[model samples]
Target: MRDLVRQGWTITAEETAALSPYIRAHITRFGAYATDVPGIEPEAFDPALDEIDFTVLDLAA
Candidate 1:
């Protein structure tokens, strides 16, 4: 997840900062992808499905 965030995977700066803590909490409890993350809905991850109301984040260079 950290690598994905660093590689610019449609996440915000604030969201990027929060990933580590979220990952830590999740790891301590259940571990990686244990629960649904807030803001990023489940459907947003589906490559085959198109979403009409999604904002595309500019990937960092």
Candidate 2:
């Protein structure tokens, strides 16, 4: 999270609006966690989500 802040990411008003309800209902129910990612807007965040590549680890192997 700190790294994201250093990278210039900020949670936008639109992103807050889009995520607030779900976050409140689901995430908060579990416990508090930081969801703030500064610098990018909601629209930008959606496209950025697609660009992420996750490396799969075969833990069972």
Candidate 3:
């Protein structure tokens, strides 16, 4: 998309309206949505994830 702009390729307002950031073609303007999430069983916890060190980090800017 950056290359297109560098090459002078331009998008009209209507064309831009048809496109979206990150996610595309999955948006619903108006609709009723429902899910039976309570009926689903949750995933079991993994004890192996506790072995990773979380305190070590290079947070300096």
Candidate 4:
């Protein structure tokens, strides 16, 4: 996630929700990593969904 952000992609809210559980768990147990991404605020994570709408910004466009 951080890698994508560093490369100029945007992780949408749905995508964040989809990944939130794993990301939160990882961050809690393994320490900071993906949460370091510019727009990935820890407060926004929600892991209660079965599906997500993933989108990315196309900087080339």
Candidate 5:
């Protein structure tokens, strides 16, 4: 999300892996990663990555 981006956290595993151990540990300690954080909107732009059928998925996949 934009909040995390603004705080310098990578949104993907690849980018996260490229980060230094210090930075990565900082993120793990203090990063804000939540699917629903009051007002931030989640993207479903990609079927492979971002597409989330929350209702169906949450119910029982």
Candidate 6:
């Protein structure tokens, strides 16, 4: 659309710089395609605690 506008109007660097990449109006008209996945969430990892052995070790003195 910028290119289309650029054909008629002379957009300067300042005007172009003001443009947003977060412009969502163009795609919002298409509506949303939603998906839900249950019981697929990953558990958080704790390397130090998870890797430790809870069992006691008896050592010779």
Best by TM-score: 6
The runs of at least 3 residues in candidate 2 whose Cα sits more than 4 Å from the true structure, single-residue gaps closed, are 1-7, 20-61
Candidate 1 residues 6-55, lDDT tens each? 88887677876775544444344744564555776554555654655345
CA shift of 30, model 3, Å: 19
* Ranked by TM-score, top first: 6, 4, 3, 2, 5, 1
RMSD of 6: 12.1
User: In the order shown, what is each candidate's alpha-carbon RMSD?
Assistant: 18.5, 21.4, 7.8, 21.6, 17.9, 12.1
- Tens-digit per-residue lDDT, 1-61, candidate 2: 4677789999667866775434444355766755786665555334455555555445535
Better of 4 and 6 by TM-score: 6
Model 6, span 1-61: residue lDDT tens: 5776768877678987988888566577666755676657778876778666666545422
Q: Relative to the unseen true structure, what is the C-alpha lDDT of residue 17 in candidate 6, on a scale of 0 to 100?
A: 90
- Decoy 6 TM-score against native: 0.33
**Residues 32-54, candidate 4, lDDT per residue (tens digit)?**
56645788555777786547444
| Per-model TM-score on C-alpha atoms | 0.19, 0.22, 0.28, 0.30, 0.21, 0.33
Across 1-61, the per-residue lDDT of candidate 3 in tens digits comes to 6788899999677987887676446777566566756687878988777777756755632
- Model 6 residue 1 distance off true place after TM-score fit, in angstroms: 5.6
Q: Which regions of candidate 4 deviate over 4 angstroms? A: 20-61
Candidate 5 wrong stretches, greater than 4 Å = 1-10, 22-61
Question: What are the per-residue Cα lDDT tens digits for candidate 5 across 1-61?
Answer: 5799999976997876777755443356766677667686666666565555565765574
Better-scoring candidate (TM-score), 3 or 6: 6
Name the lDDT of candidate 5: 0.68
